[model samples]
Target: MTNPVKGPTGRVPGWVKVVGSVVLLLAVLFAGLRLSVLPGLKDLFGTETRDRSGPALLESIQDISRYEAASGNFQVVVDLEKDAKFLPDAVRGSRTLYVGAGTVDAYVDLGALDGDDVRVDDDRTSATLRLPHARLGTPALDPERSYAVSKQRGLLDRLGDLFSDNPHSEQAVQKLAVRHIGDAAKESGLTGRAESNTTEMLENLLRSLGFKEVRVTYGD
Candidate 1:
């Protein structure tokens, strides 16, 4: 039998060359498919999101008898940090910086007025009224205006977040912000301004009602 032709030393066999060429062609085709078609497939299969929420229900209606006389806007920066007892920050601690914005309203309750609260002169030219002092309402935080500035978490904290439903909750910081805003409103003379505004409003209304002199007073 004749011997098969042999290539030079270190040279690859003809069948090996054929197999390599086929592999190269297949690799090029696969790369082209990845560049052109894979993205569309991904979008069609696993990339879309759907909202599955239920419709909102109207709970209750309330009648507001308080007149808003003043509003104060406030902003606060909250820096909160938590660390483990014996571990370093890099291993078990978290720090968050947040900006909170809210508003506090001061008002006078008109529904609390009784018949004895108002007295008119015999000639109907003068009036006297006694009302309760203005009070501050609950602070309302503006979600659109509030945001987290920065967050740093240790390895353990990050790993814990993967299993938690609310990975990064702002409830604590939000409560702190509300407290600060409420305190600031108390120090801002908002209630005093509300009282003054209510007095002015009542005086104007009484004068328009034919009373020449109006005396408005606030009690505890």
Candidate 2:
């Protein structure tokens, strides 16, 4: 989604044509991206998204890693794909099923579950989910132990690389989003298509996992 063209667009100035073309290409890419996810991404368009089903437990949802939604609060957004309340589900907070995306420094929160043999890299950038001779239980989650499964293949994670032409593949989407939107990547910037679409993807990921209150700030 990083369509970093040199300038702006139009019959007005020197950079307009270049910028305009980039904008258009980005737009097309974004449109195609939107189409790819279509109904799937609807829950996370401008705001957030949520899916409310039965007391569906994480119930052996193995591999819940890679995309970590940073420590934050929740907001509610209706699903663009469905007539149901999307983002709010996360806030409701009962039995839950969440999908999130983040840096995933690859650490396991032993404090959260049954885990042991804690280890860290020299850079403290990655960690693993281990169990102290205990196994996983379904419907009946044992607060004492279980592996923090982390896998990369969420809808957004998959969609992020759709047609990105990105060197880092789809995963680059997150880095790109965070980098571009950093501190100043808020408020004014939501004009370009690819970038905007990327924004959509990020928002969708958060909402799916229940981070409904995602404040998006885009950049040119």
lDDT of 2 by residue, 45-152 (tens): 555568777685665656553222122211111111111245442232122112212221111122334323444445544443332221111112222332222333
Instruction: Please report the TM-score between candidate 2 and the true structure.
Output: 0.16
The deviation in Å at residue 194 for candidate 2 is: 60
lDDT of each: 0.91, 0.37
User: What C-alpha RMSD separates each model from the true structure?
Assistant: 9.1, 27.8
lDDT score for candidate 2 against the true structure: 0.37
Kindly report which residue stretches of model 1 are placed more than 4 angstroms away from their true locations once superposed: 1-52
lDDT of 2 at 194: 31
Give every collision pair in model 1: none
Q: Which lDDT tens digits does candidate 1 get at residues 70-120? A: 999999998989989999999999998999999999999988888899899
